[model samples]
Target: MSEAAFETEPVPDRERFEDASHVLHGPAGSAAWRQVLYALYVVALLSGLYGFTVTRAVVERYGQSWRAAGAVLPVAAGGAVLVVVLLVLAHLAGRRRGPVTPDPAWVDLVVASSVDRWLTLRESWLLPGLTLLVAGGLLGGVGGAALVGGGATGPVALPVGLGGGLLVGGALALSWLSGQVRADPSGPSRRGIGASLGSALRMRTALRGLGVDGLRAHSLRAARIGGATFTADTRSLRLEVAAPVSRGRRWRLHPGGRVRTLLRRDLLGLRRQPLLPVGGALLVLPGALAAGWVVAGDAPALVAVLGVFGLQLGAGLVAEGLRQHGDALGAPRLLGGSVRGQALAHSGAPALLLLLLGAPVAAVSAGALAGPVAAGAAVIAVLGIGAVVLAGLWLAAFRGQPPMGAFGPNGGPTTLLLWWAWPRVLSVAVGALVLVRLARLGAGEAGIGSVVLVALLLGVLLPVADSALTRAAAAHRG
Candidate 1:
């Protein structure tokens, strides 16, 4: 089933990509078995958790530690049952492996086609989206249940469930749609292993200048026909196939004329970043203010919120400066460079300064603090915070390797903790200052030099100390 001639022709028709995606193409029996196993596994796992919790709590409440085994008899039995069910599942999956049952060749062909179709993601969008919708609905239900469990009226908000479902569902649907759009029209046909081998050999000749002595790519399924994979070779070279997915000129959309640059990238990836990784992150100005309200309360919360906005302004500046600085340094060698661009490049210092100045402006507006009195203090605090960020980045950049490995002899989790913890520590310090300031200023409180003076002293002290030590260390080495 070689696809050589199949691809040249256009498709005569396609059931809307959605129909193709959602519909089943596999043989009925295996499909049915997968459905049953999935359902059983999910039920067994969740029920197991509930049963364990109930039985344990009952045993503990009875005030008999040794005799509690008898009290949790039901839990023990349930656990045993779950183990048996899991074993049965493992056996079935094992059976799905090795040997083609009905005419080895036919079995091979069926398995190969099914596996390849999924791997390549060349199918209809509707199928995947429906699958995701059902999955998202179940997940949302669980989340809503938890929210309700916390004594809130979670069940009353149907919109939350529906919105969660659509957001997750629409995303999956769009992903499926994209696959369909990219899928080669003559996708179903197969090709010879010998030709695959030849292609591998040619690629080797081009890249490594080595003849392809042998190549092996584990297909993960014994396909009878219509799909194949070319894998492993002695050439360890990564062979990265890079190409531009986007192109643009930097332009700020912010009021300050600062282009967001590559801030969000594309529409799809608008909010896709692992910034804080685990959890507990604030997005932008609004989020910053909301978080302040929660943690700092009214008046000071307003100031804290403003301070966070300043941090964002600073971070954005640093980020933009890094980009332009790299460009100006002739990185990637894009040239016929502009003098105007260099003169007014996005610089980190300015962003940091704006944030520093803005924080006091935001807080002093309450008239609790005298504005003209504390200008120096606000500038000082900004400088200290900025220095912390710059120093942290510089250290990490210098280290330039994972915590623990051959190159990083002082590596491992310990190194990671020491090296990467700086940014977080700085954030905490800044957050604490804002939080404390708010507590001191209640709506009734008023002051001019008090807060401002403190900030100025810290600002001047930290940077001067940092520069002095850095210079000393360099001089000593030289």
Candidate 2:
């Protein structure tokens, strides 16, 4: 080869470095970043307009002396302090184990190579850091605005917000620092020493004094020498570790029949892997109940809104249960039956469970004023909501390929606009109407006919629609 040709050739090291950098940081980083920026812009613009109007409305209602708005500050401050303390302690405890271990590829390719560790690792921390900073800033801004609007303090409000943001930001930074310190290979010996000393501190006495012997046992450990490093005992560390658990027991049933076979397997799967179902219920049910209770006194219409929302939450759990089976769509083909019949068989357990769970909550939420008959109607309506939710989720799952654009693998705002979300929204609107009718029934303005009508529409009509939709979707796919 000519000298000129050799001179023009690209360096192998530079080429390899570029390839490694792209893999570490993600090839689509620029596009993803742009999308995030656009999303933020849209959110900011919408929030600014909505917040301005809301602020103006609040000001007009209570003037600058809106002290009621500040009533929750003391409570909020206490909660914030408690949360921050818990986070810090949890973070510290996490550090005892060491920072998150990198992926096998990242360890083998990036760390073992001559490349800078910071460059490869920065991508992991950058997104989290930005998220924390934004969250802190937004929380501080909101709290400050509320305080100022309520006339809690004039000049102090802005400072308070800034301070709050800084406090949160600092906490996050400390957590990141702890992780980095743990990850540093050279610091393990020093960290182990610190752990040993910290383990011996008067904190144990304080924990005993506070009557948290369990915590004391978990937090502190006797020192042990493992090679050159002195570290806390592993027994105490093991005490702090938690294992995942299921929410319910598996049902034992004769598996001779096809339906029974399908149900038995599904029930077992759901009971054994109940985390998602239980977690979704726990996360959503309390908020729904709280909202229902708040509006229970106003009128049934408001309570009905809660009912709809509550059902939606419950529906999500049912859907999760169905998903656990892994045979929702294929059961028809495997078992040789009509799609609709198989779908119904698959959905039976979830629907029954939903009804069982929703009945009491619905009755209580209707209040004593609802009387027995109206209360019965409300309970039935709630069950209907569950059925609808189950049906909707079934259709969404088997009706076609799960939506791909927004909610598919990369979840985003588009997920909220899915066919699944639409049913919840529609349920709320329908609930308002049904609740208004129930309110009239209780007051003697409407007859028993209204009660029966609502029940029929919800209990019978909705499930049929759901079954039909599921069958149609299945047929289309076939």
Candidate 3:
């Protein structure tokens, strides 16, 4: 055969391989349509419910403000914040399991063969991208409907909202693809946004250069992680997603007293995973802002509930030491202290971090939006709430596996979910209740003495709860 003919022959063979693979492995025609229809039905139901409930209520309450001049700036700012958050999350998720992850079997067979990698993987990427696009459009449509119902805008908003959502969704899809390319071990070195975008847009060409071995390894890892998730094997899931410690490796821990050493160890850990503190700060800032608004009476007490959840998540990130301790419950204690003592020592870093980060933001937001009195109260409230949230995160960190009964024949997914989530839920509920009662007291609807008494009661209760959970987890581990 001629050299050119020999070189061109493999291209057709690769195309044929992909075509046959799709015919053999892709979902059946009616089944695929049924899946699509079911997804649409579910999305429509959710959008309808949201439009009639939360969206409508929000639009009714803030519609006039949304229509006022300069409202667009704040709305745009919030949207930008959300976009940044989503992009960060997407990048992290890509590091764990990228957007184009295929089945382990597919990777072993087709991907390991002579077929074009992009030909085999493009479908996997397209499915998720389209799903995100549809989801975004539906969300926007629901919001647009709510705005119209609340008289915030005209019928024109519907198409505009949908168009905007499509654009946002497309951007998100591109970001996800960029993350996948960045995560590829044999791909080009990390580059600027323009470079990433250029790579994503020409993904087929990019895939041609990716190492098949790396893709296979990642595919297998993704499968194992998926299995862990399905079985609720939190430890395995955490291990799978835990990035290697590459930062602060040269930093040495100093010798000190036991408690001091524990605190330093956690701080060192945070230094190693430097992004944890950054992510925690991002979460805490908005939470603090919401909390300030609630405390200053600029927003309803219900807003504090969201703030409590955000604070808990943020604290959880910084409380990795506590979680690691909990995971080591059945093991020997090299740290030479009781589990509870070590746990409390571990809690110090997160609590202090929360206070330092939350207090100033809450104070400023309240002072600027309300007044000096509210600012003082907001600062105090933020500190208290941060402590409460930190304690709750400590409890959640130690919450061991759910009881077998939760997954027994009598129980189901809902029961197991609730069992796993109960600690965080209870903590948020209690925190919100406290904030609401305090708000009422500030508004002169309740007596200070009673409010303080309730506060004191809760302050005692949370520790007892945390201790009980720790003991239970230890017992379960034993």
Best by TM-score: 3
Query: Candidate 2: global Cα-lDDT?
Result: 0.49
Candidate 3: give the clashing pairs: none
lDDT tens per residue, model 1, 121-175: 2212223445555655655544444444433344654457556655654444333
Q: Across residues 320-421, which tens digit of lDDT does each residue of candidate 3 receive?
A: 888787777778778688777888888987787778988788778777766777777777677667666766776677766777766667765667788768
Q: Per-residue CA lDDT of candidate 2, range 240-354, in tens?
A: 3322333444455556566666666655655665643564454245323423332233432334565555555555554543443323444336656655555566676566555
Better of 2 and 3 by lDDT: 3
Measured against the true structure, the TM-scores of the candidates, in listed sequence, are: 0.37, 0.56, 0.88
The TM-score of predicted model 1 comes to 0.37
Report the Cα RMSD per candidate.
17.9, 13.1, 3.7
Q: What is the TM-score ranking, best to worst? A: 3, 2, 1
Task: Rate residue 223 of model 1 by lDDT.
Answer: 31
Clashing pairs in 2: none
Best by lDDT: 3
